[model samples]
Target: MNSSLLKNIKTLFKDTFSAEPVIIASPGRINIIGEHTDYNEGFVLPAAIDKGIIAAIGKSEGPDCTAIAIDLKESYRFSLKEVVPVKNGGWRNYVLGVVAEIRNCGKEPGNFSLVFGGDIPSGSGLSSSAALENSLVFGLNELFDLGLSRQEMILISQKAEHHFVGVKCGIMDQFASMFGQKDKALLLDCRDLSSEAFPIDFGDYEILLINSNVKHQLNDSAYNERRAVCEKVAAILNKEALRDVTHEDLLAIEDRISQANLQKCSYVIEENERVLKAVEAIRNNDIKTLGELLFASHHGMQHLYKITCEELDFLVEKARENPYVAGARMMGGGFGGCTINLVKKDKLESYKKLISESYKQQFRKECSFYHVHLSDGTHMIQTTE
Candidate 1:
């Protein structure tokens, strides 16, 4: 956890709770390589980062659920019996969504007082919302003896975001938040919901995230549009998602799709192959090959997917130009967000300084950067002091 965020959580608890409340944490995630492949039922390599949402929660006597955000300094209350959507700036939608989803699933919703905060930079492609939702649902699941397994909880949290929060995301964010393992990245098959863990064996190297600080609200619509286009192509070819199509299949009927849609379909198909190759590289400890795959993925995203922006493209290019960087690519929904890069461990500081100076000179905006570690997923702890 970020020390500042930890200090704030401690101060909030000291000021508000006469008794120590139960503490629960769920980690945010960084997609090390895969981009936009989750919805296409392709493979993704993601790890839960050290940064995440931490919640201090306690049961309430009444039927009303109350939650306060230490970071935003905002408090919200809702009736457990009558859950209604907040009209504006409802950052609490993630929490409310979970409650509504659990209730809809024929489960009883309970009341609680929750105080939460996180160090995960919002809009940095780190899945902060998923961390928040997963933490809250996990806390509630334990507090109420809901008897839900990890996968069940993941699905519930994902459903909450899709139905209540209104973002059509796949299960990846929730799965990583709930099931991440330290020093390993998860290879998730978005099609069958099957996954395997792969050790991140880049010796003497570390992952770094450089936030562009430009929030891309258009991501939601663009994501849906791309998904629609893929679906259209799939329908024309009489298949499911692009995952069903092989590279040869794509080549054979490449002209059946429009130029733009063909590019999209090809990226998804080739990206799936890249992901498999990345897995092999990791298993064989071939850092150089893995790095090349990262660069190739970014090129596909920039030229084919057309989701990458100038700033993100610039960051990737800058990182690639540096001899110390193994690989770099724009992560998450991405009109703008973060570029996930692997930098040589011994040269991390120098690499950061170089990138920051160059990025600032070119973009005229200082970039926010974080060194992240693969971390354990969600867990609950009872605090007694």
Candidate 2:
């Protein structure tokens, strides 16, 4: 936990609302593997990371809400009854969406004051949006005594993104943010929202995230388009989702769908299998196989799913060229974001320096690096009066 950040949020809320507030630490997430397979009812290996959003919230004296984005130095005020998305609202929409979804669940939420900020770097493919959403929902649940389960809270978070934020994201981000345990990666089945936690031991290698530092507008639209293609292909095959289609099954009907759709379907099918294999690899302590799976996953994303941007590809390629890197792949709803790399712990600094210089020369812009550990999901911190 960031003690300084938590203190700042508490101070901000007290200064704004003139009252002590309930605090929640909602963690951003990193997927070890399994990228676009979430919505297809496939598998994903996601872990909540140490960096995330901290929200301090309290009930308003009246029926009005005020939220402050501490990091952005912005504030928004709204009626509790009129929980609508703000036009051109970036972060406000995430908060409001949570409130809206909670109301949809037939729970009455009073007006509240919110102050939130986070250390999770934006556009780094670390699910900060989900973290923020979860923080607000979790905090609101506590403040209102809504009696919502963690499972129900995650669904509200997911719907908040879909309805208010306009991102048709899958439940993986919210689930991982809500349920992740420390030092473990969740093998989440999107089909039933069930997960098995596996100990994430990379031996001498540690997880490194290389931020390409570029976010194209194509991310959300491209994500929606790809999801549509998956659904269409699944319907054509008469399977419930791509998870039900085997490699041979996809190959059998290769002629029926467009080549583009074929590639998308093929990647989803293969990627789901990779996730299953990844769990086994972890079970066997085969880091090499795990690393190879990461590389293959990126290849599928680059060629088949067609989501990698030049900056992202450059970072992954740089990791591929490194002897210290066991595996590398672009993480998140790619256009430009971070590539999750498994790097030798001893060579971590040198590798990061090399990649930094190389990426600067290649792109003429600075790329960021984050060394993140798996962490527990969203939960409250005791507040001091």
Q: Which candidate's TM-score is highest?
A: 2
Clash number for every model? Answer: 0, 0
Candidate 2: residue pairs that collide: none
TM-score of each: 0.94, 0.97
Error of 1 at 66 (Å): 0.8
Q: How close is candidate 2 to the true structure, as a TM-score?
A: 0.97
Per-residue CA lDDT of model 1 for 305-365, tens digit only, reads 8998999999999988899999998898878889988899999888888888998999898
**What number of backbone clashes does candidate 1 have, counting pairs of residues 3 or more apart or in separate chains?**
0
Model 2 Cα lDDT, one tens digit per residue, 1-385: 9999998888888877789889999999999899989999999999999999999999889667889999999998899767788887888888888989999999988888999999998877898999999999999999999999999999999999889877878889999999999999999999999899878778899998988889644324588899989998889889998889887877888888888889888899899999999999999989999999999999999999999989888888888888889999999998987899999999999998998898899889999989899999999998652
In model 1, the runs with Cα more than 4 Å from the true position are 2-7, 10-20, 218-221, 251-256
